[model samples]
Target: MQGRVIYQEHIDVLIAGGGVGGAAAAAALSQLGLRILIIEPGPAQGRRLAGELIHPPGIDGLCRLGLLSDRSMPGSPVKGFAIFPADKDDPASSVTLRYGEKPGTRHLGRAIEHRILKDHLLETVQRFPGVTAWIGARVTRIEENPDGSFTAMVRSNDGEEIRIRPRLFLGADGPMSRVRKLIGISHETRRYSGMMGIEVEDTHLPNNGYGNIFLNSAGVAYAYAIGGGRARVMFEVLKGADSKESIKTHLGLFPPLFRLDIERVLATSKPLAAANFCIVPNASVRGNAALVGDARGCCHPLTASGITAAVKDALILRDALSESNLDIATALRRYSRRCGRLELTRRTLAEELREAFLAQTPEALLLRECIFSYWRTSDKACVRSMALLSTVDTSIFSLATQYGTVALQAFRLLPRWFFEKTVVDWHRGVLRLVHKSLAFQYAAIRQWLY
Candidate 1:
């Protein structure tokens, strides 16, 4: 491939996979006057973008990158999250947690079309004379030199092969990243189930300016307003559920409180697109190469932290590389240590939520009741949970405390759970419930302690 390279160049940083993380990395790194080359397979303009919502930390990250301005790109401002917990009897029960309700932090989130956001970041990078963006390009090979530089072979849209050598190589190519594999990094992925996402026009949420999540035994439903009379709805369907069902069939899985908003959106929306909800638990770095975004790791859409994590990765990587006297090994090590810690917190939080609500076992449902009850009755729990979910505080300590509280609450409810289960399964259900709670607590404690 090197011999076949018709063109060759040197870049300060060579990034593969020019999606949210890659594009943002280019934009941020260009500020340091470093030559950056981004090889992306997508068109110059993004076609379809998932993960449209940006939590507060992500918003702050984009602001730091200079992609978010006062006027900002076209989008809606989200204040907080409204969660509708699962109740087989009364699904309408709900609780709203305002982001602003927490002290020392402004309560604000942002929602924008994923495509529009990507284009803005790309355009920002292109404006920098030091950055070169190759749309419709794919990385074919990467070779690490003895001097800690990387030689990457990229093929353009026109079938032109070009080789690039850079002091550092960043892989922001997303979940199925070729760079991650080429650099010999392995990730464990679990695809829990599938979700149906629909984009509706002229649709408004009942809780406007907030991300709405409706949890049920069937699955989870999410609704948030994007800008310009539009909103995005995602439904995590139960196993064996039909994907081709009408919009109403899918949206109906939500509670009655959400039915009107769901129907309004469905009436004006197109057919929903089904996708899998997956998480990659370990997306750490290796050698001179590092992964970011879905490439680094992905979480359940239930958490809605993908966009925020990606933007934060971009910032972390850019800052790490910009440090003085930093060798490639030192820079990547710093990124791994910092980003890995945050990734663990994000992963643990999503796991706790999914196991409590979406798992759908009798024991899981019991756990959900205890967890949601805590959220509804305890203001401190509500604030801390929302803070962790929003990435405002990506610390394991915060995550551990929230789950720890939930575990203790579950213990207090164990007697009631035992009474209810003994009639049905003669203590089997009660034991399962206990096991579920203990497993979560053990994992969380181990993560915190070590």
Candidate 2:
């Protein structure tokens, strides 16, 4: 059976899923005077719980592309992050890590609502010349031509089908991307945890203008202001835990004032729930087709680096195309090569951070203490950590160095271990640390070289 045909169009690029990555790519590629068509499957008013807090690098990328402006986008300014240690009742025990302490970093991050941010981005991209977007449309089928191009069939909300033939096809349809599957790319997704988010009004944070992270036995809980008199609190729900009960259990971990606010919001509204998972694609590019944003890969939100990584992907793709002089094959290869290491670092860092913060095992708890000690003792350590977290520095060498430093800090507990524990336990801890340190270095070096 054939569907109703609305119109046929020829474009330079066909972007699937007009979300953050697609909008960013359209805005960036429109500068090259290319005709770009963006088809979004979801309606314009669709509200999905997704990334709302963006790091400094993402903020800079959006501003650089002229898609985001302080005056145009109404959101809260996040200077940095404030981390409260587990079992610590004193507010004074919290450690604050500020942005811009490192060179070449933005002074503040932004925390807009997810729906508002997506709408603003879509609106901004649609205003760009040579860019067309279909809000309730989706690419249903993609056919590859022998000459290295794609013919995509898009169906609108009303069932009207439009055929598009473009020189380049980008898959930005997110973690469960249909385009990625259509392009025959295999990906592995691992479920880490679950997250529940609630928005509260007039909440007071221990440190204003910073994201507050409260460490707990279950998982990590995050609280930060999103906009005018409004704040967002997210609780990480471990596997097999009751979502509502988990959130209620974590609420008391926050400061008294913030705890009261969360209770009030809980009484008034239901929290939005989303799964936290990571996807690692076998490959990001094949022939003239490519994957960007979460379509390429994603990590747990413990790092809050999803939006930042997506923006960077767009910028890197733009640079790759320009450097390759718009040659589709060469540009895709360049993009793949440049993004491979960054994705590896992001995924690995997110996994390690989550493991350390959650601290289910003895070694993990030790590593967590060492991390806190490192942050407390050295201002430079905080800057470096923030730099890595902000995505301003993606070098695996820097990551290895930081890991080694943290590992060495763990070694300082050797004497205490010998005094407080059995000799066998001390020996086992030493062996485990050594094994982990070596394995991490080996992986980092191999990944860097490859």
lDDT of 1 by residue, 331-387 (tens): 788788788778878877887788777675666666676677688777667767878
lDDT of 1: 0.73
Model 2, span 1-450: residue lDDT tens: 255433225578889988899999998898887899899976645457789889989999999888998676678988878888776556468888777554565778989889888888998899999999988889998777687566678898788877776788999999989999987899898997888888887447667688888888778898888888888888999999888778867876777887888888788877788888899999999878899999999998877889889999999999999988999899999899888878887887888888888866677767787788788877778878887887878877777778878878766766776687744554665566677677777877887677
User: Scored by CA lDDT, what does every candidate get?
Assistant: 0.73, 0.83
Clashes in model 1: which pairs? Answer: 100-107, 174-295, 175-294
Q: Residue 87: error of model 1 in Å? A: 2.4
Q: Estimate TM-scores for all models.
A: 0.87, 0.94
User: Model 2: which residue pairs collide?
Assistant: none
Top of the candidates by TM-score = 2
